[model samples]
Target: MSLTDQLMTDMKVAMKGHDKVGLSVIRMLKSALMNKKIEVGHDLTTTEEQQVVVSQMKQQKDSLVEFQNGHRDDLVAQTKEQMAVLDKYMPQQLSESAIRQLVQQTATDIGAESKADFGKLMKAVMAKTKSQADGSVVNQIVKEVLS
Candidate 1:
């Protein structure tokens, strides 16, 4: 099933099971996806749908950090639950070792030997990994590999 269909199915199950957190997260995801479709004025491809989920996950990560830093334990727990819900929609993430390997291989393929080639290396690795790898982790690995 497409992401939307999956969300719809999950939404109904959440409602029936009285899963408030899951229902809220699914509704938020549906809203984001709908907004993206309206913005593009066309049906979203599978890649586009994944991008939306990744974007949502990124926001949740940022919120999670802020909540932790602010010592809001209650909010932190809630955010973590939201993130858990979002996780179900994401593609399997790349391990750090896998990302490092990809960075090395891509750097070799692109002949990126110096830090100056950081942009090129990063673009290539991210293109290959798509939404599977976190950009910050990839960035750190790219810098380590290039330097």
Candidate 2:
């Protein structure tokens, strides 16, 4: 089934199970997905849907950092739970070592020898790893490799 259909099914199950947090998270994701579809003026392909999911996950991660700094333990715990739920929909994350390896490979492929080639290297690496690695992680790996 499509991600949207799967989400709708999960929403129904969450409702029946009396899972309030799960239901709320699923509702928000559904709304985001629908809004993204409207923005693009068509049904989302799987890649577009994955982008929407990743966007939501990024928002949660940002909020998590803010909550941590604010020392809001309750909010932090809640956000962590929501992040966990969001993660279920994302593609598997690449490990730092794997990301480093990818950066090395991309640099070799593109003949990127210096920091001046950072942009070219990043574009190539992102195209290859967009669905697997986080942007910040990839950026760090690239910096480490180039430096």
Candidate 3:
């Protein structure tokens, strides 16, 4: 089944199991998936669905950072739970060493020898690495490799 379908199924199970937090997060995810479908006036491809899931995961990561900074351990824990749920739906994430290797290859493939070529190299690298690695982490890797 597709990611969206799996999410819908899990939503039902969460509700039946009386999992409040899980239900809420799954509901929000379903709503986001539906919204994208509505925007495009059609169902999303697996890639599009993955993109939406990844976007939600990114938001949770940001929220976790803010919640921790604000000393809201409760919120931080909640966000972390949601993030873990989100991660299960994603493909295997690249290790740091793998990402660094990809960054180097991407730079070489694009002939990016200097900082001026950073943008070009990053575009290609992110195309391959998106959803597998965080943007900020990817950016730092690109900078280090290119520098």
Candidate 4:
């Protein structure tokens, strides 16, 4: 099933099971997906759908950090729960080792040997990994590999 379909199914289950957190997360994601589709004026591809989920996850992470730094334990716990719900929609994340290896291979393939080639190397690796890898982690690995 497509992400929307899956969300719809999960939404119904959440409602039936009285899972407030799960239901809220599902609705938020569904809304974001709908907004993206409207903005693009076309149906979203699988990659686009994944991008929306990733974007939502990033927002949640940022909120999580803020809550933690502000010492809002209650908010922190709630944000963590929301993040967990969001995680279910994401593609399997790449391990750091896997990402490091990919960075090395991509750098070799692109002949990127210096910091100047960082952009090229990053672009190539991200394309290969798609939504599977976090950009920040990939960025760190790319810098380490290039330097």
lDDT (tens digit, per residue) of candidate 1 on 79-129: 999999999999889999999999999999999999899999999999999
Point out the worst 10-residue segment of candidate 3 by lDDT: 84-93
User: What tens digits encode model 3's per-residue C-alpha lDDT throughout 107-147?
Assistant: 87889999999899889998998677778889999999888
How far off is residue 99 in model 4, in Å? 1.3
- Which stretches of model 3 miss by more than 4 angstroms? none
Sum up the clashes in candidate 3.
Answer: 0
Residues 1-147 of candidate 4: C-alpha lDDT, one tens digit per residue: 999999999999999999999999999999999999999999999999999999999999999999999999999999999999999999889899999998999898889999999999999999999898899999999999999
Clashes of 1: 0
Of the candidates shown, which would achieve the greatest TM-score relative to the real structure? 1
Per-model TM against the reference: 0.96, 0.93, 0.91, 0.95
Error of 1 at 43 (Å): 0.9
CA deviation > 4 Å runs, candidate 1:
none
lDDT of 4 at 13: 98
What's the distance in Å from true for residue 108, model 3?
Answer: 1.2
Better of 2 and 3 by lDDT: 2
